[model samples]
Target: MTTQVVILAAGMGSRLGRSLPKPLTELSDGRTIMQQQFDNIHHAFGKRAKVTVVVGYKLEHIVEAFPDASFVYNEQYDQTNTSKSLLRALQASQPGGVLWMNGDVVFDPRVLDRAAEMIARDQSFVTVNTAKVSDEEVKYTTSAEGYIQKLSKTVKGGLGEAVGINYISAADKAMLVRHLQRVDAQDYFERGIELAIEQNRILVEPVDISDLYAVEVDFAEDLDRANLFV
Candidate 1:
C-alpha cells in the first residue's frame, strides 16, 4: 500500500527550554528528532511515501535540514496547538494513507514498518502503539477491547503513552480533519484524536511495542529519559 507521512513539527518544546525548534533537538545518536522520524518512514514505505511536514517554531531549521520535503507553515502555531497544525496539511495530502505523528518523540525505526503494515492491512483502521514509560506517568486510557477512550496525559491511569504515530486512511481523513476543526483552535492533536473517538468512528489497533517508548519532551528531564529508549 502506498503511504504518505504527516509529521506535526510545530512544538515549542517548553519542556526542553531550548531556543531552537523541537525538530532540531538531537537524540543520543545525534540525529535531529524530526530527521529520525522522517528517515524511519522513508525506510519503511520507501519512496512511495511522500512526507508532508507541518512546521513552526523555527521553520527554517526544518527547511534547511530536509530541502526536498513538502512543508506547511502554521503561522498560528504559537496560538494554536497540535490539532490546527495537523489540519493545515490536509490541503496538500495525496491519495494514500498518512502516517501521522508528532515531532517530539523517539522510537525505533522498525516501529514505522509495524505502523505502516497495520494500516495497509486494516482498511481505514487506526493503529496506536503501547508506550513504555515509568510507573507514575499518566497513560492514555482505553477499553478492554483496546479502543482509545481518553488520552489524559495530564491525568493518571493511562494504558500507554501515544507513540505519536498513527495510520490515517483516506476514507477517514475528512472526518479526522473536520473533527480537528471543532477542537479548540488552541487544542493539540491528542485532543483532536480523543474527539474522533467520541464520534464513534475511531478504532484503536494496539501494537505490542514496549521496546519503543515515547517521550513527549515536556521537560528537559524527559530528554534524558528519551535517550534511554533510543
Candidate 2:
C-alpha cells in the first residue's frame, strides 16, 4: 500500500513578484521554500511514498534543490493549469495510487496522514478544507458535508482555500487520465474531478483541517509570514 506523491511546481507565481518560481523562494529557515515542504512530507511519510516533483519555471533551481526527488518538465505550464502539470508527473510515477499536491501550497503534516488514511479506506476521492476564508470572495465552494461543488473564482461563500492535499487511489487513476482527455488541456484538474463525481464515479472524503496552520504565498507579505508553517 505504498503511495506516490506528484507535486505540481511548474507555475511562474507572478503574484509573488519573483523572477524565479515560487518553490525556489527563500524561507526563514535558510532552505528554499520547496525544501521546507519536502522536509515536512518526509517527516510524515518517510520512504513510504516515492516523491516526484513536476517542474517547469526555473526548473534547474528545483532540480538543484531536491536532487533526489524525480523530476518531470511541463513546457505547457505557462499556458495550462496544474491539472496538466500533474498529468506530466503521472507519466513518470509508479502505477499505484497518488498523493497529488501543489508544491507552492503549505500544509500541516497531519493533513498528509489524514489523506493517506482516507485513501487507504477504499475512498475514490479525498481532499482537505477549512471554513476560515475572510475575503468576501470565496476561494472554493464545498458542501457542508465537504463535497466540493465548484472551484470557480466567482463562487461566493467559498468553502475555503483547497488544502491541496489529495489521495488518488489506484482504482481512480484511470478516471484522472480519462477526465484529462475529455477536458481540454487548459482546464483545471479539480473541474475534471467534479465532472467525474457528477457521473457518480468519484467520492470525496473531506478532512476539516481548519485547525491546521498552512499558507500559500504569491506575495512578499506571505513570504514574510511563511515562518508560521516552517
Q: Per-model C-alpha lDDT, please?
A: 0.72, 0.71
Which pairs clash in the backbone of model 2?
none
lDDT string for model 1 (106-148, tens) is 7777777677667776444333445454454434776777666
Question: Candidate 1, 88: how far from true, in Å?
Answer: 1.0
**RMSD after CA superposition, every candidate:** 2.7, 2.5
Worst 10 residues of 2 by lDDT: 129-138
Alpha-carbon runs more than 4 Å astray in model 2: 134-146
TM-score of each: 0.86, 0.87
Flag regions of model 1 displaced more than 4 Å. 122-138, 154-156
lDDT for position 83 in model 1: 82
Displacement of the residue 224 alpha carbon in candidate 1, Å: 2.1
Candidate 2 — what's its lDDT? 0.71
Question: For model 1, where is the 10-residue window of minimal lDDT?
Answer: 122-131
